[model samples]
Structure formats: C-alpha cells, structure tokens
Target chain A: MPDKEKFFEQIVRENRDKLYRICRACLADPDDAKDLYQEVLVKVWLHLHTFRGEAKLSTWLYRIALNTAILYRKQQNKHTPLLPQHISELPDASAETAHKQEQEVLLQKLHYCISCLEKQDRLIISLVLEEVSYKEIAEVLGLTVSHVGVKINRVKQKLALLMEQQAGAEIELDKADKR
Target chain B: MNFEEIQKNWQTQQAPAAEAKAGGATAESDLLVRVKVLQRKVMRTNLLVAIVISLTAVAFVFILRPLLNPNTIWYDVGMGLTLGAAFALGLLHWFKSMPWKKQVNLSSKAYVEQVLKKLHYLNTANQRLTPFFMVAILAGINLIYFDIFWNENIKLRLVMHIMLNAFMISVGAISLYYSKRHNDQSYEPIIQELEELQQKLEEV
Candidate 1:
C-alpha cells in the first residue's frame, strides 16, 4: 500500500472506537449512528490530505466527527417521524451472563438519559464522558474553554439527577413486583 | 451510578467492527461520485432555467413589436438591454453554481482559506451584478414603454408611464434591499466562522 493509505488506516484503527462512541452518543438510533460513522470515515478519508498538522490529528478527527454527526441529526429532525422511535432496542441480553446483562441494561439507561439532553449539551457531556479535555472540547465545539467547563458541570449534574430518578423509579417497580 | 462510574462504563463499551474495507477507499470514491452526480444535476437545472428564461425574454421583445414602431431607437435599445440583462443574469447564475475542482492537495488551513476566498468572490460578484441587473431590466421596461406610449394620447400616456415607473421602482428597491439583507444573513456568519477557524489553525 501507498504511504498515504497506510497512514490513513492507522488513524482509523486507533480512533475508530472514539469516533463510534461520539456517533452513538449523538444519535439515538443504532442504524443512524452506524450510517454517521461511515459518513465521518468517508469525509476523513477525502479530507485527510488537508490535515495541516496545525491541530492534533485526534482533535481534527473529533472536529470532523462531531460536525458530521450534528449535521446528520439536523437532517433527521427535518423528517422526524410522527412517533419518535424508541432508543434503538438494545442488543438482546439473553446471550450474556447475568452480570454482563446488568451492565448492558445500565448502559442503555445511561444512553436514554443522554438522548434526553438538549442537543448541544448532549454533545458536550458525551465528550466529557469520553475524557476529551475541556480545551479540546471547546475547540471542537467553537465555545470558550471556560464555557465548556461550566457547561460540563451543569450537564453532569443533570445526568446525575436523571440517573437518580431512574433508579428511584426502578425501585418502586420492584416493590410493586414484590407485592 | 455517579458520573465517574458512567464514564468508566462508557469507555468499556465495544466499538463496532470496521464496516468499510481498507481505509474506506471505496466509500470515499462513492462519496466523490455522488457529489459529481449532484453537481451535474444542479448544472442541468440551471441550464434549463436559463434557456427557458432567455427564450421567453427574446420572444417577448420580438412578439411585442407590432405594438411599437420597430424603427424607433427606444424600441431597439429596450430590446437590447432586456435581452442582455436576461442572458447576463443567467450566465452569472451558471458561473456561481458550477462546481470547481476540489483543492485536495492544499493543507487544511489553506484549503479552508481557499474556500473562504471563493465564497467572498461569489458574494462580491452577486452584489455587483445585482444592481446592474436591476437597472438593465428597469431601463429595458421603461424604454419599451416609451416606444409604445410616446406617440399615444398625451394625457393617457403620461398617466400610464408614471404609474409603471413608480411600480417598477418600488419593486426593484424592495427586491434589492431584501436580496442584500438575505445575503448578509446567510453568508456573514459562515464567513466569520471560517475566518475564526482559519485563525485558530494559524495560532496552533
């Protein structure tokens, strides 16, 4: 393979998971997330030569991924269905061991809470959870670093409250089952 | 669970398998093809619209000659200006919409700067062409009226001429104002953002 192709493959391999996670966080539907992932990859490949070494490659990748994902969401919204689809049905848990199944359920709940967030806040918190630095996140999002810090704190608190409410609801259901 | 625990879980989730083969070479090419196809579609639509409008203007100038003296200077000038403006506007639209080759070899910052430059050029072109187009069409219409009405009953011709001029002027002014406002609203923010991005790239 040519040197350019090899370099491109290496980047993809290293950051595929990060890109996938960003897509999944931004899009509620699994299929839409996958489509967005592919779209981002194609864009990255097409624009790879333009990478100027100005921003870190990973930061550039995040910039592309987030922008593509956000645009995809906007396009989807214009054609939004009368009934919003359920957070894409999680993969069947029956195949997993009990502990793994529990983890999957928790992850699904987490994703549900994320889906409830206002669009920009969802992206901010998703990057926060992904361990992207405040400065890089601000750069990707075109916000001030200080603003990113404040927004992240607010989003985190919101998520905590959501999780608590979900947990409370689950316990109440358990009590009903016991009765 | 707390935010930290959620972050840990998020990190542990498996990434999906790579769906495209070999650095997405096929997918990238597919996208390029789609873009080309869309560009062609736009060009076709623009050409069709241009042809139709040009033909209509031409026909209007020729078919209306029985109402005006063909030998009159105003009639000739009016037809010439109307056709010229119509064709120029069509040509301008074509130039603006046609796809240029992508400058893939340039660095990202340079590429963005190039795009910004092109956008600025287009905006400038539209701004300059718009007034000329407005004036040309307005002159054409007024001249055509002058040819047909200049020899008619004096009082009736005067009333009709004044009314037509007032109506066209109001429409032209309103249109020019809105076109400028619309362009500023649509392109100014994008231009500002790109400039900021270019600056950030340079600083880095």
Candidate 2:
C-alpha cells in the first residue's frame, strides 16, 4: 500500500473505537452513528494532507469527528426530533456471567443517559468517558481547560440525575407489573 | 452506575473491527472519487459564470452605446465602471469559494475559529460592497444614456430612459434588501452557535 493509505489505515485502527463511541454518544440512532462514522473517516482521509503534526493525530481526529457529528445532528434535527432510545431496545449482552450481564446493562443505561444530553454536553461527556485529558478536551472543543472541567462536572451531575430518574421509573414499572 | 464504571465498561467493550475495516476502505475510495467530481463541478461552474459575465458585460457596453446618439464621456466612464465592478465582484466570489482554502488542518478550536473569522469577514465585506456596487452600476447606466435624454427630440427616448432607470433602481433596492436579510438569517445562527461555543470555552 502507498504511504498515505498506510498512514490512514493506521490512524483508523488506533482511533476507530474512539470515533465511533463519540458518534454513538452524540447520536441516539445506531444507523446515524454508523453513517456519521463513515462520513468522518472519509473527511479525515480527504484532509489527511492537512495534518501538520502540530497536534496529536487523535486530537485532530476528535476535532473533525466532533464537528461532523455536531453538524450531522443539526441537519438531522431539522427533519426530526432527536429521541433517546429506550433502554429495552438496546442489544442484549451475550456475557454468560451475571456480573458481566449486569455491567452490560449498566453500560446501556450509561449510553441512554448520554443520549439524553444536549449536543455539547454529549460531546464533552463522551470525551471524558474516553479518558481524554481535560486540557485536550478544551483544545478539541475550543474552550478553556477550566471551562472543560466545569462543563464535565455539570454534565456528570446531569447524567447522575437522569440515571436516577430512569431507575425510579423502572422501579415503578416493576411494581405495576407485580400488581 | 457511576461514571468510572461506565468508563471502564466503555473501554472494555469490543469495537466492531471487521465491519469498520470492511466499510472504511470502500468508503475512503468512494469519498476520494466524490471529492474529485465535486472539484471538477466547481471549476466548471466558475468558468461558465466567468464566461457568461464577461460576455454580458461586453455585450451590454456595446449594445447600450448604440441606443444613444452623440454619447458623452460620462457614458463611456459609467459603462466601464459598471462592468469593471461586476467582473471584480464575480472574481472576488470565485476566489473566496476556491477549494484550496477549505483544507486547513488546524486543531478543532482553531479551525472553527478560523472558519468563523473568515465567514464574518466575508459577510461584512459583501454587505459593505453590495450597495455601493449596485449604486455605481446604476449611476453608470444612467450616465451612459444621459446625452440621449439631453439631445434627442423623441418623447420615446425620455420615456424609455425614465422607465429603465426606475426598473434598475427598483430591482437593485429589492435585491439589496433580500440579500442582506438572507445573509443575516443564514449566518446569525451559526455565528451565535460558534460564539456560544467560544463562551463555553472561556468560562472560568
């Protein structure tokens, strides 16, 4: 393979999961996430020549990925209201152990909570979950490091509240089913 | 569950490796082809617009001069200024939208800020230039025909001159109003979003 092609493939291999996770977190629909992921990769490939080594490749990827995802969401919003997927609709975890199954369920709940966030919040939280440093997140988002920290705290608190509400609603539903 | 647990699980979950690889290679080539096609289309369109505008400007200068007898120097200057302004504006637009400038590889924030700054500058420049260009063109056309009204014996010449001036002025005014309104409507939201993003970044 040519040098550019090899470079692209290397970047894709290293950051595919991060890009997809960011897309998936921002968009509720898996199909949309897939489409956006493909779009982001294609964009990255096309602009690969512009990668000046001033920032880490991952940071550059995050910038493009986040911008594409945000723009995609805005375009999608014009035609339809964005709705978070119900937790029941999530794919079943095939883990044999109960502990793994519980973890999978919690992960799905976390995804649901993320999907409920506003666009910027979703992006900030997704990067946080990816273990991106606060300063990097700030650079990726064009915000100050201090602002990124505050936004992350606010987004985490919001997610905690959303998860609690979801748990409460599930408990009430369980009681109703017993009745 | 707390964020740490969610984060741990997020890291551990399997990425769809096979699917990503399969889809990515095809998508990359397909995107390259699309980009090439788009670049060709834009170049073709720019060439076409330049040809059309050049032809129109030349034709108008020649065609309008013959309509008046004993044409004055103002007519020549007016026509020259009008067509010159039109061509300049057309070239400015083409240069602004050229594909080369769109490929900056800056960090996300810097990239967004760069784009926003470019857009703001373009919007402001276009807004400032449009009315002045329109008025100059209109004045040029009127000057080109000024001698016709002064020297001609026919009532039709006066009537025609008045009617043409009225039509041009009305069209210019209406277009200026709509163009400004449209620019504001289209750009304000994006500008607001970028500013909000900036503000979020700046929050201490």
Candidate 3:
C-alpha cells in the first residue's frame, strides 16, 4: 500500500483494457498481445516518475504501448504467459456466447488486417479504434491534426479493403466446402 | 463490415477478463511477482556492469604496476595510455545509454529517432573504439618489451616480438570482424526497422 504501487494499481485499473486492445490490434497473436501488454505496463511503471500531466494519461499510456509494440521483438522461450489464463482469451474460442464468438471472430480478422498495415499506421488506426480524438492522436504521434486525418483516412481505407478481401476469402472457402 | 462497425466491435470487446492485481489473488500475486522478477533482472544487469567496470579497473591497476620494468619512464607512460584507452572504452557506454533511458517519454517519432541514434552509436563505437582500445593495449605491451628484453639475446627478442605482435594483430582483426558481424545481425535490422517506422510516421 505504498504510494507508487497504489498509483500503478489505479492506472492499470483504468487503462489496462484499452492498452491490451492496442496490443491486440498491433499483434496478430493473442499471446504476443498479452506479452506486449506486460511490456507496456513495465514501461509505464518505469516512466511513471516522468509523468507531469503534460498530456492526458491515456494519451501517455497509448504512446508507451505503441512505442513498445513497434519495437517489441518476441522471445519465444522467455515468454511467461500473463496471468488469468482463462478461456476468454481472444484466440482461444472454446466457451464464448454466440455474440461474443461473432465479435471475437470479427476482432481477430480486424487484428489480422491491422497487422498487415505498416507499423505506424497500425498504431495510428489502433488509436483511432480506441476512440482517441484526431488531435490527441496527432499529439501522441507528433504529427499535425491534418496529417493525422490524412493518415487515418488512408489507414481506414486500407483496413476496409483488407477486411473485404478477408471476407471474400472466407466466402470462397465456404463455397468450396459446400461443393 | 463498415469501418464504423469495426470500430464499434473493437470498443465493445472485453480484453480477456482480468482485474487489477490489487486484491492479492492468484493472478494478482503472480503478475506482481513477474514484474518484481523483471525489475530484479534489470537491477542485476546494472550490478553486473558495475562489477565488470570495477574488475577492469582492478586489472588495469595490476597491469600498470607489474610485468614490466618500472624503472623505464616511457614504459610507464605507455601503460598509462593503455589504461586511459580502456577507461574511455568503458565510458562510451554512457553515450549509448543516456538517451535510451529518456526515450520512454518521447513521442513515437522521437522514440524512433532515439532508437536509431542508439544503434548508430553502437556501430560507430564498435568501428572506432574497438580498434582504438586494442591498438592502445598492444602499443603499451610493445613499448614495455623494450625494458623487459633490453638484456635478452637479440634473436630471441626479435622473434618473440614478431610473434607477439602478430598474435595481437590477428586477435584484434578477428574481434573487429566479429563485432561488425554482430552489429549487422542485431542492431542493423533494428535500425532498418526504425527507419522504416520513421518513414511511415512521416508518410502523411
């Protein structure tokens, strides 16, 4: 119950989910997303001393997450899978409700498409998906607001095209199965 | 699905239900323990570096005092220069690491540049300081040979000198080759990746 631990706990409570989403959007593997999430938290804790309210806390958090994700190199042997190893894990689709299953599928496809984008674009669109404002995304990415808009448009268009291609492939597979 | 639908789905999905590790439950305790382990590893790396530096200083102290005729003033100066070069090599790490520590707070563009800067520093340090350090050490050893072999048979001195210099030069060359190879295998790809990220960041 020290001050730093308390502060870390509160920040994690508020932002861990969104941070994980950013990781999930950037990396296709669920395990890698969790690993990236832990890496981001470690960095967040390390840099907590530097936070001076210069930017919104979530913006700061997203900056850390995206930076880590951009440069994160996966170590296969050293990965200690993060805790709460439950079935609700996104890629492990054993026990979800119907709507949950559908959402998971869509999210997985979205992750695949996100992974296919360029690295910075992945971070940009991930922030966009998190409902971060264009101005804030601009600030986090060190770009002008108009630049953020332009990039977001290009990323969205690319994402839509990728998702459509994925849907087409899925439909083609279904037709082949029926045949 | 439309982009808005995809955005809604992203927002609606729960990120693998797990609470904050505050209640001291199994996962809560486990995660905190992992973080502690990671923090401990970082501490251990720092400790190891300090130990190596202290040991290097101790080794230089031993080298400066013994195995050469202390009566010769030039020999003493040669050893001093060698130790200075070694210390300089050690201090070069500070150049590579100071910016890395501050990069956690930077924006993405700045962070990418910081990473590239660190890697470029690595290659530059390897190219320049490795030769400088090895040559200083070799020069020191060669200079001390004058006093040590002053009374030895001339043939023995000449052959031994040639052999030692040849050995040292070969070792230095092999190390430089491997250092370059190491940089290429590791830091080069990272530099390329960062540069590409930087370009992507600026593409708009």
Candidate 4:
C-alpha cells in the first residue's frame, strides 16, 4: 500500500535504538550484542510490512528480537566448545577500556541472573529495561498487567540476591589481593 | 547501590537517548548480516528441492502410465520432465519475488515459520501422491517385463505372473511401512519446533 522502501526505512530509523538495546539485553558480550543488534535491524527491515499495527511497534519489535536471540542461543548450545570470548563481548561493557573490567564483572553476574529467569520473566526484564510501561509490556508479552508487575518484582528480588553474592565475591577477592 | 536502584537508573537512560547515532555500524551488525545470508541460502535450497522433486515425480508418471500401452514414446518422458521443471521453477520464482523480505521483522521468526509451514505442506502433498507413485512404478515394470516375456516366447505364464505380482506387493508394503515411520518422526520435530516458536512469540 505504502511505498515499500520508504515505509521500511522509516520503521528501521524509528525503532533501531530499542531493537539494539534488546539485542544488548539478550547477548552478553558487546561485540556479540552489536552483531545481534544489526541482525535484528536487518530482520526488521525485511519484515516491517508484517507489522500490521495490531500491537504497539515496540511489542512487535520485542517479539522479533527475543525470538532471534533465543534461536541464536539454541543454535550456539548445539555446538561443542562454546566460545570463551562470547561471554565478554557485551556492547556497553566493551565500549570503554577503563571501565571494561568492572562493567564486565557486573555484566557477568547480570548475565547469569537473567539466564536463570523463565522465558516470560526474561521478556519482562528486557521490556522494563527498555522503559516500556507495565501495561504495554503485558500487551507486548501477552501477560496480565498484574502478572507482569508481580513477575517484575520477583525478578528484581532475584537479581538483587545475585548481585549481593557477586559483591561478596568481589570483596573476598579484594581482600586476598591486599594480603 | 542496591541492584534495584542501579537497574532503575539504567532503565531510565536505556535506549531512546541513543537514537542519534542509529546509522553507525557495530559488531552486532555482523551477526545480522550472517543471518540474512543464511536465510537466502535456505530459500535457494528449498526452491531447488521443489524443482527436483516435481521433475522426478512427473517423470515417474510418464514412464509408468504409458508402459502398458503402445502410444507413448521415449520423447514423451523428456517432455514431461522439462514441463514439470519449468512449472515448478515458475512457482518458485513467484514466491521469491513476493515481498517476503518486508515481512521478516526483528526476529525473522515469522518468515522462518512460514518457510517451515511451506515445507510441511509440500511433504504432505508429496506423501499423498506416493501411492500413485508406487502404482505407476509397478505398472511400468510389468509392461517392460511383459514385453521381454513376450519377446522370449517364454512359457510358464502362470508362474511369471504370480511371481511378479508377489514381488510388487511386497515392495509396496515395505515402502508404505517405512514411509509412515519416517513421516511420523520427521513431522514430530517440526511440530515441536513450531510449538516452541509459538511459545517464544507469546512470551515476547
């Protein structure tokens, strides 16, 4: 109906950031995150016409990004000798050399915590992190708003416990270095 | 800071702010490129398979149907194969040229799901024609064997007919059994994967 090329370019330009952030959320390493981000963009470009406008564009985008990441993860698991660098390649953590080590430490813990979540919980966190409304997140994720709220609270608590444990480990390592 | 506080801060500043540099290429970009390449490759493979299978099927039809009758010629076989190939190739081209690219979206899940569905439909259609395939092969074999038997002026016609019938029945039975078994196992994985894909979509 619309000029196909123009419509696709507009959708890509408009939603690129959100898509990129979701990619970063799913992937651990920055390089891998960036790679996943671009992949999502290309997919969005190719699939933009299917948008149908039934849900918010963000929800639709989330659907695509999450599915792609999960498929990629599933595929990676099938191969032997998972790449070591994959864990450290997160985009935000890898961007600055000075903060890279600390950011990586924090991200590694975050990664483990997120991975432990149920698929629905992971969707909630990704959406919440992207600053989507609780209602919108529910709509995008096909959950009740109350259910989303409760899940978000539970995930937040779980993440807190995980971060605390990582913090304790860091303190122990600091003490050993001092000794 | 507590994780909640840090996460809240992180969320507030998350994505919309970085919209300015949306055009730049990043490492994540590479993964996307690879995915596109793979998608195209899969599409090509599917087209090739459809063409080859259709040609083989049509060729089988021509060879078997005319063997009992004297009207068909060897050239009919070649013509049938060519026509089947051209028809299948045309359908493949139509699908490829369709704006399937615009429907791919952020995950490529929808497109992949469509591709899987197409494959399943093809398999089912192919399976439905399988009985015809078996009958045609047997008919063709009988005609050729009859020609040879007639040419040799071979006697014991009762024994030859009985043996040929038994052999055809046995072969048909074996093929049907294996076909059912293979189809069940193959379809299970695809159905399971499609279910998983649906679950993932709902979660999204």
Candidate 5:
C-alpha cells in the first residue's frame, strides 16, 4: 500500500473533477458548488481510510459529495436573506433572450423533476447522468444489479411524468400571458 | 423528450469552471487511489496506538509494580486483569460499531439509519460495560482484603497473590477471545444488512 498522504493526494487529484460535477448538480450555483467541492475534498481526505473497497470509490465519493452539498445548501437557505425580484434580475440581457429562455425552461423543468424524486431516486438519477454503470452503482449502493435497473427505470418514469406536467404548465402560462 | 434531445440539451450547457470536469482519470483509477489513501491513514493510527499500549504495559511492570504495598499484589493483579478485559472489550465494541468499510451505497434513508445505529451502539455498549467492569474491580479488591486480614501466613499470601494474578490474566485473555469472536460474528451480518439496504434503493 502507498503511504497515506501520497495515496490521498492521488485520490484527490484523480476525483477532483467528478466531485466538482456532483457539487455542481447539487448546489446549482457556481460559487456555492466550489465551496462544496473543497469541503468534499477535505472530508474525503479525512475519511479516506474508512473507504473499504466493497463499493467502487466513485460511488463513495459521490455519496460524500452529494451529502455535503445538500447539507450546505440546507444551511445556506436557513441563514441567507432572499433578494427582491428587481434586485435579483439577471445582468446579462442575453440570458433572458428567447433562445436562452427555452434552455432555461428545460433546465428549470429538469431541476424540478429531480427535486420531486425520492431522495434515493434522485441520487441514482444524478449518478446515472454521470454515466456510472449498473454494476458500479450496485457496488456503491450495496444493491443487486437487477434491483438498480428496476429502480432506475422507475426514476425515469417519474421524471417523464414530471416533464409532461411541466410542458402542460408551460402551455397554460403562454395562453395566460397572451390573454 | 427523446434520449438524443435530452442529451443534446444537457451537453450544450456548461457548468461553472470550478465545478467542471476537465482532464480527469478513469473511475477505476479513482477508486484505487481513494482506497489506498484511507488504508494508509488507518494503518498509521493503529501503529501509534500499539506503541502507546506497549509503553503503558512496560511502565506498569517496571515502575508501578514495586511501589505498591507488599500486601497489594493480589489487588494489583486482579485490577490489571479486570482492566485488561474491559479495555479489550471496549476496543472490540468500537471496531464493530464503526461504519468503516460499510457499504457506502446507503441511500439517504439507509445512511441515516446506519448513523443512528452507530450512535445507539456506542451509547448502549458504553453504558452496559463500563459500570460492570468498575463493579468487578470493587469485588476483586474486597476479596483480596478479606484474604489478607483473615489468613495472614506469608506463604499463603504469596500463593493467593499468584492465584489472583493468574485469574486476572485468565479474565483478560477470555475478554480478548470473546471480543474477537464477537467481531467475527458481526462482520457478515453488517455486510449483509448493508447489501439489503442497497437492494432496496436500487429497486426504488
């Protein structure tokens, strides 16, 4: 086995990217996600020895990263004051352009869909988006391969339902705006 | 939306720079690196503990041994044995209770449950064992005082002290043996429970 410090450094260097992705997905804010990224790295460093190889390291890192981000966001929301609508408006007018609106709508739908998932379901979908394999997911989550497949299917179905609902709402909003 | 559309939409968006994955290694290498890092830290901690225990044992034998009253050998031996057993038991309990190498695949629910279990185990184990061992030491001391006051032949006293020391060693050894046994028995069950929890999440 490699010396502890060297081994931890190598792990940090290796997973720094994936950890960031996890933070980005969870936090949805660049600066907050960056803070989450560093926090996850520190935790991984501290708890590195606790990683038994029963699950893939990616799964473990994902778990830690997601949990940390969620906790941080929960804390932030409790303390931070919300901005007024005018003050919070985007500086880049391009961000509100018609082309960007469509993308934002989709992103908003995706976020709402994800949030509506059961916590476990949400985690699985997030990991799936990261392109984790069923076997690795199973290992990380201690699930059987077949079980992961079934659960993932359920999550997809739920997401599809959410997307459909969002689409219906968007149509209603457009009509209301015209009226 | 179709997979292609969804994929395309997602691909077009750029996550913030700090949250981006630029040039990263494969997942397999990442896993290997993490495991190696953690193993090294644990091994170092274990080594440090072993050294401390060795030094403490040496001090007990060389320094503390001669300072006790001549009549107190039995008391010392009994105390040592009881302490040794209790310490062994405590360590074993802690090792078993730790979530180290536990299935990291806990869905949020399972993770919370595991955390609760860990806390409960720590509390219950400490509550049950610590007091009992303290009582055991008190009993041992009482037994020694009775023997010394009631039957005071020097030769018999020596025999009693030797016997008490032997008894203490036996207790310590027994505690250590049971500690190992308890750990072995619990390992598979812990892994099995974790596996089941994972399956539940996967089926979600």
Candidate 6:
C-alpha cells in the first residue's frame, strides 16, 4: 500500500523473469540459482532507497543480480556440475508438439553449452539472449561497448562449437541406440 | 541449432521456473515483510550494542573510579582503554555500514573495484589498528600501577612492571597473530574472486 512497497512489487514483477534467468545462466544448480535470486532480491530491497533514477531499473537490477551471483558463486566454487543437469523439465512438455520437443532439446543443448563457457561469458550471453543491447550489457557488466561486442562474438562462437559437439555426441548416442 | 535460432528460442522459453515462485500477492507481501523485518532487526541490534557499550564505559569511569580510590593516572589509563575500544567498535560499525554507500549504482566493474578497495583498506586498517591499540592499551596497563609502585621498592616495582609488561606483550602478540591470520583467511578468497571478476570484465 505504501510507496516503497508499491515500488518494490512493481520492480520485482517487471524483472522477475530476467533476474531468474540471469541466475540460471550463471549458476549450474537450480537451487543455487534460486538462492542467488533471493539474495539479489534482498539486496534490491535493502538498497531500494539508493536508486537515484540514474540507470534504468532493469539495468540496475541486472547489475545487482549479476554482481551478487559472481560474488555468491565465488564462495560456491565446489558446486560446479559439468553437465546440463540444470535443464530439469520443459514447460508443459506433454502438451507440446514434436517440433516443440525438438526445440526443447536444442534449448537443452544451449543450456549445456552456455554452462561450459567462462562464468562472465555465460552471464554476458544470457543478457545478450534476453535482447539486451550491447550498451546495456556493457553497462550491466562495466565493460566497453566495443569489448562487449568482441566478447559476445567470441562467446557466441564458443557456444556454437560447444552446441555442435553436444549435438554430434547426441546423434552418435542415438545411432548406437538404434544399432 | 544456430545462434540466432537459439537466441530466438531463449526469448520464447516459458521459464526456468524458479523454485521460490510462491503464490503472487501473498508471497511478495511475505518477502517485503521479511526484508523490512531484517533491516529493523539489524538496526535494533546495533543500537543495543552501542547502548550497552556506552553504559559499561560510564559505569567503569564514574562508579568504579570513586569506589576504588585509585591514582588519577589509573583513571587516565581506563579512559585511554575505553577510547581505544570505542575506536575499534566505531571502525567495525563503519565496515558493517559500508554497503549503504552511494556506489551501488556504479557499473559492475566499478562496483567490484570499489568493494575490493574497501576490503583491502579494511584488512590493512585492521592489521594496523590492532597492534596500535595493543601497544596503546599495553602502555596504559603498564602505567596503571607505576605511580603507586614507583614510590615504594624500586627493584620490586621494576620486577612487577616487567612481569606485567611481559604478560601483556605475550598475550597481545599471540592474539595479534591469530587475528591477522583470521582476517587473511576470511578476506583472501573473496578478494581473489573479485579480482578475477575485475580482470574478466577488464579484458577485451
């Protein structure tokens, strides 16, 4: 009802998916991602007053979510899972078509490949996937726009290679299964 | 899957579906309450600590002094020790409140850099502050019985002073060693991580 509560709710509702996805992108564990998201929210609420309307709220939220994840995962170095163990379930998989199922598999592979890149690269690509502009990504990451462009190119190439390797491995497994 | 295609799918994907997704209005209200409660709790605890410290200092200076009838220099030593302790607590308080600084709005690299600076400053300040206080307090304690004992047996007073000083020095030195070790152990990993992040962002 109060102004602060209204502002907090609005911000959370608006950026809920973005924050959750950022957490997911950076951390390999869903539980850890959830924890990181909560920590980010706690920070946002605590530091709500410090928001001086300088940066867009989403950009500010991105900075907080990401900075928290980097620092939080610094303490959780041992929890890294080398697989795409994070892709638990496709949303409403049973109701979707076979084409949708194939898309889900590719999405799974994408998650796996994203998990394989460097931590900062993973975060940058997540923002890039969200259609965030290079300038905003640079701002969120404290990088030059040109550097973001450079890193995105590199990460995208790496991700593509990783995905190709992953898909090739999957096809081999399928052939073996057929044999 | 092509990069452009995956990028498109990423946008259309329904959700990673965070586990904390509780019912809408109720859950948000609960979170708001929890955050507010936590903020209030920290403030209350800090206030209580400050009050208790003030009360103890007052009781020591006013009540204990008149009751014991010690030398005037003894009171000065007590005052010095109190001020030393207050100074340490003040620095710690500042450290706890460091996050509220206006730098939060800075970009992530600048934010991490600033945090690293503060952490390094806190570490160095702690390393320097501890020994400085140890020496100051040790001097104060060593001075305490001096005016009284100095007037009497010079050898006995010298022996007592040396014993007390030796005890204070040994205790202070051991604690200082452990304190510095603890600080490094706790701060080093975080500092290392922040440095790595800084480098990652700084790299082209």
Query: Which candidate leads the pack in lDDT?
Result: 1
**TM-score of the B chain in each candidate versus the native B chain:** 0.67, 0.64, 0.69, 0.48, 0.39, 0.63
> Tens digits of per-residue lDDT for model 2 on A21-89?
887788777666766676677678777889999998889999999988877766666323234345555
**What local lDDT score does residue A6 receive in model 2, on the 0 to 100 scale?**
79
Clashing pairs in 5: A48-B38, A49-B38, A140-B105, A141-B105
Q: Assess each model's interface with DockQ, reporting 2 decimals per model.
A: 0.12, 0.11, 0.13, 0.10, 0.05, 0.10
In candidate 5, how many Å is residue B131 off?
A: 39
- DockQ, Cα level, model 6: 0.10
Error of 2 at B64 (Å): 23
Off by over 4 Å in 1: A78-94, B19-204
Model 1 lDDT, full chain set: 0.72
Cα deviation at B8, candidate 2, in Å, is: 1.0
Tell me how far candidate 5 lies from the true structure as C-alpha RMSD in angstroms.
13.7
Query: Any runs in candidate 6 off by more than 4 Å, and if so which?
Result: A82-96, B14-204
Candidate 3 stretches greater than 4 Å from native:
A73-94, B20-204
Native interface contact recovery, all models: 0.29, 0.21, 0.27, 0.20, 0.04, 0.18
Count clashing residue pairs in model 6: 0
Local distance difference test, candidate 6: 0.70
For candidate 3, the per-residue lDDT at B14 reads 51
Q: What's candidate 2's DockQ score?
A: 0.11
Estimate, for each residue in A71-100, the C-alpha lDDT of model 1 and write its tens digit.
Answer: 777656632211122423556767778777
Backbone collisions counted per model = 1, 2, 0, 21, 4, 0
Better candidate number, 4 or 6, judged by lDDT:
6
Evaluate candidate 1 by giving its C-alpha RMSD to the native, one decimal: 15.4
Order the candidate numbers by lDDT, best to worst: 1, 2, 6, 3, 4, 5
State the C-alpha lDDT per candidate.
0.72, 0.72, 0.69, 0.59, 0.58, 0.70
Candidate 6 chain B worst ten-residue window by lDDT: B17-26
Off by over 4 Å in 5: A1-17, A24-35, A49-55, A66-91, A95-101, B11-204
TM-score of each: 0.54, 0.55, 0.51, 0.48, 0.43, 0.56
For residues A1-179, write the lDDT of model 4, one tens digit per residue. Answer: 24754665566677776676666666655455565665566556556668888887778888888877776666545223223334445666445685555555565556655655565566577777766888987777678999889988897787677667766766787799899
Chain A TM-score per candidate?
Answer: 0.89, 0.89, 0.85, 0.73, 0.68, 0.89
lDDT of 5 by residue, A1-179 (tens): 34755776667666676666566556544456555565576567557779898766777887777777667766666322222222224447654787776666565567556655665676677667667888877776678999999998888788788778877877787799899
